[model samples]
Target: MIVPSSLFASGTESWRGDGRTDEFDSVATASRALADGGVTAVTGAFGFDPSGTAALIAPERFARGTRSGASRPLPAVVSSALTPSDVHTDRIRRVLAAIDEGVVDKAVLARTLEMTFDGPLDPADVFARFLPGPDAATTTAFAVPLDPAPGRADHWLIGASPELLIAKTGRTVTCHPFAGTTPRGVDAESDRRAVAALRASDKDLREHAFVVEQIVDVLAPLCRELDVPDRPQIESTPAVWHLATPIRGVLTDESITALDLAALTSPTPAVCGTPRAAAARLIDEVEGSRDFYAGAVGWCDAAGDGRWMVSIRCLELDAAGTGVTTWAGGGIVAGSDPAAEVAETEAKFRTVLGALGVDPADLTDRSRPAPAPTST
Candidate 1:
């Protein structure tokens, strides 16, 4: 057997990355292959917009230092840290109030609220909430700066991402599009319809388009040669049908890193919205605080072939390890319903509910979904 450590021979070797953006349809197979191939980890690089580093990370103590994407004899890494921004509670409240007042009909609002644990935070405890069985499908990963440094957070997270971002040798760069989100439906047919509707919906297409364009746009400046699909293809998973696109290019300068490219593609339209700047501004003003929820938090090699998940499916652990603080959001198009948006938020938070070690019945609380309008 090729020992895992022996599989990679690129130690300090020059890299020419070849990347392809796959979708959920390819995730399982691809991940399996990576595992079978003795890849330390197979990651979904764009996870930062939702779960922060919780997907591609394996539970283990990694050797320290930033390994380049093309490094050899190391665990497969996912991303570099994208820290949370200052909380904007006032902005979130304004939008919700606007929605409630009917000044605006629909808007996709998000929050990055922070919660502190008096003691050390253990993500394993946080993960306990979501994975029903010990063997439940879940992954949590982070890069803690070595030593007791009092600077940036030593730890990060990306709870559970369904997407993957990739880059490889040969100067190729790519992203795997994964969307068409739906909850675990009451029945197979219900889930099927959710997937089907998302696939057919124009709004969903618009959302996918936003991400594709941004990926292309983001990678454009960094690449010497580029190739983007004219249209996205349908890719299905157990729970969703993502709009997948293939983006490939050669790096303009090797000095620049894949992490840099991943950084640019983060908060893509899958989690954010079209007209990204406008959407983020609106969200910043409307969604309150995002904390680390939507930030890109993953580890990558020195060459940048790691995965980063959006920190969506996660919860913040309390020091006592008894409870967790969590948040969720939805894509609010002009046609969205207040009640439906509320329901979607509720659905979006399911994974967190599980991570907090709370039963679905346990989350019933007085916090109702507040409205957000376009009046800002």
Candidate 2:
């Protein structure tokens, strides 16, 4: 349960609720209880075996990540080890077919394919290889474990995402945007150039625009005149630099709680897509799934305002605590290159691998090359 803001220390971040909640102590039981009690929404790890208990979850409580935000909504979770046949996968298959039929040129879809090593995965060993050093204040980047359910085994959701999803203080709301991804280079100069390229990229700019626009559109009716900027700026670090945009607005009315706002905006275009209705249809045709991969995966208070990020860089645990899945994808516009898009997925996978301490280089079977570090 969320501790009231009054319980926490006050400051510029006073809007932050008291940081009193603990990591979910019993994932499986809590998940099950939510399921049985008819909880409206639940989200945890991103790699639960869709064929297992995770798939049985109701849409709200058992929602997926990446889809947690608007601009990044991929219909399915993405990973290397997942099997390709399920209801979500089937939906993606339909979406892909439609794209093939001249419906949508670019539909973002993902998978959470998992792998088991001889040992437990560790993020410390690998995160530095990709991300290197502590970069920003209030910035967190790592491979975190997702408890499949309360009391279940730990599952890995990997990635180097360094953006805040949402934060609230009373009636005020704050959001961060992470789009326009670029890979780091072997040399410092080249790395800088890569980041520069991302900042100046038309495709990236458009992708960023789509999300920023959507946020303003969705919140205008509900918020007290948003403070979103006209253009996103280049926010960078050694590993990755994004066109970070911060959105702040006050709740226009008090009838709804924070949870109500989350329901309306948690999966904005920043994590989903532009023209959401059409994008979802295209996803069904091109990618083929709608399990919990790209849905909301954060906690909430009765007031509803809580911090939730796009469920990027995460995994869901499977039954028997062995198998797993994870999701990753990128915005595909008219100029999107299939190969580069594949590379972006590879870059995202490193966050998971680094967290698991699994060497991405160890995999030779993947169709893509070993990923160079990129800002997640």
Candidate 3:
């Protein structure tokens, strides 16, 4: 077992898989092989966009299963943190225009902040120091390496995601998607008001329901029974509050694995949008490349059971660690505002920004250049 001790907190070694595939069936081939071997555990990541690829890995070295001393804090100085000013807003404006044109109902647009560190970064530390309080208990934190495929460098994807793409155990599956978002305020009263507003906001509710409905539509065909809540509950992280709904169902086909369920429901309305094909086209035309920003990441076992979380609030780091790119964004509907959407992206970047010792609030300045009309 080749365990790398200095980098990760767990000291585990995984064989990273490689390449992107055009179809979900290609991604499932690995998991099906593991299941045929009896009970086993495999883990890794895939991309956010449909045509993108995946890297599902099997662990060659395992953790010691022991706790260490108190975790260390992240670095305080940021060499540089930057985002494209008018570009982000312009992207959102175009998507909104599409919504008005009846091309799509909603689309989750994303923004990335690229940072150059003074030295190599330890992804494990990034995951550990982010949102380190009681409220973060529900979050799924990860730091894993991608396979060494052609044109793909040895990079690690790290972050804490609060949305569960899919989880399977026995013949049961669960999907919890979060859509509507409100930034948490510094004061308790302010925070409470924010939560209340999220629940009451018609736009937020509609955005949240689209995600729930998409998951139901995908799973209903494969499951014997399913349960979806009428309303979303407020799921809180240290930095933001979200409208989250947990959908549960029992798979009629025992042969169906967790990976299969994830493939079906991924790029859900929460991350992608409604009338998927239209939203995908808009994303391609407006947002450029998403890479793995909103993709699914986690593990599957030999028994066909596994867990995958929506890859949000994350960063991609080079193996050398000299650079990092953090990602965050939100759903854009008819009522979405350009400035408000910009602020929402900043809110989503809080966990990573905070860990990097940068004040996330600094990015919310509305004075940033306004987006020009699409004709420009």
Candidate 4:
């Protein structure tokens, strides 16, 4: 986890195993149960759907220090879209129509890409590629083993996320939510123009407002004093520029844990939308199960201090390690252009796609025929 002052990396030496919450119902209940059972720290992932299952564990021992693996050269891999480009854009158009009818103010639409390698892929190696230099502090890189579903094998959820869902230490809490997006420009002048355009975009600003408003609504009652900036600043990753607001507050109740805050604030307009339930229903009708793709991942300790990050720019590695599925998404508002939304998701995918040695331009090339859908 990346905190304001230090970076923490941990490896499990022994697993309590019993701490797994097969079906995550309530973060408060599950966390209380773990703490009652003497688990010092509970770590794992929460599925995207609030009612879906979660993979959490209590580690008996944690080995910490510098990250210990060298990134291996990724082998040639086959790539295919789980959700085709045309289908995704069509979904966006449908959402635009819904917005017109006032069914929902905004919704987030997502798509996935599957990459199968020639040989076994190492989760550590792939994760290594996500880490920046030692001094880099903004991105949080994670690799958590997921508890397999009834018929599925063990897998790992790995990513380098730029958004923090929530964090807590003592009575202090903070969140940095990102919404508006634009791809980074190739040249210095173009990059500056891109950032300026995003700042002035009415559509993008509207989309970002929904996210910040929702977050404040959720946090206000729980906070003794909240600080929300009037404007969003630009946050940059290697491939995209995001409109981000850094929110900080002092909790009214020290009893509120990080996981509790995460559960309450997540699925914010950043990933789901305003009137969250309506948007979620629309997503369900169109996108189907998100699994843990846009879920929250991180850890909570017995002291109720911890951090959780939104699971974007992430991938799930299959048990055999030969295949990985990664996802990207964009928030859809009334004025959204279908084609531009498609391009937005492509730009979001560049984080993991570039790390995998795939040129992101391949995703945007219209001359190339779309790959056939593949079974995960």
lDDT (tens digit, per residue) of candidate 3 on 29-70 = 565666567324556677765345776555543232322322
Against the true structure, whose lDDT is highest?
A: 4
- Model 2 alpha-carbon miss at residue 25, Å: 18
Q: Which ten residues in a row have the lowest lDDT in candidate 1?
A: 2-11
Clashes of each: 69, 86, 2, 0
Ranking by lDDT: 4, 3, 2, 1
Q: What is the TM-score of each candidate against the true structure?
A: 0.60, 0.65, 0.86, 0.88
| Model 2 regions lying over 4 Å from their true place | 1-106, 119-134, 137-161, 237-239, 364-376
Backbone clash total for model 3 is 2
Worst 10 residues of 4 by lDDT: 10-19
Report the number of the highest-TM-score candidate: 4
> What is the TM-score (0 to 1) of candidate 2?
0.65
For candidate 2, which ten residues in a row score worst on lDDT?
A: 5-14
Q: Model 3 scores what on Cα lDDT? A: 0.72
| For model 3, the run of ten residues with the poorest summed lDDT | 5-14
**Candidate 4 overall Cα lDDT vs. reference?**
0.77
In model 3, the Cα lDDT at residue 216 comes to 89
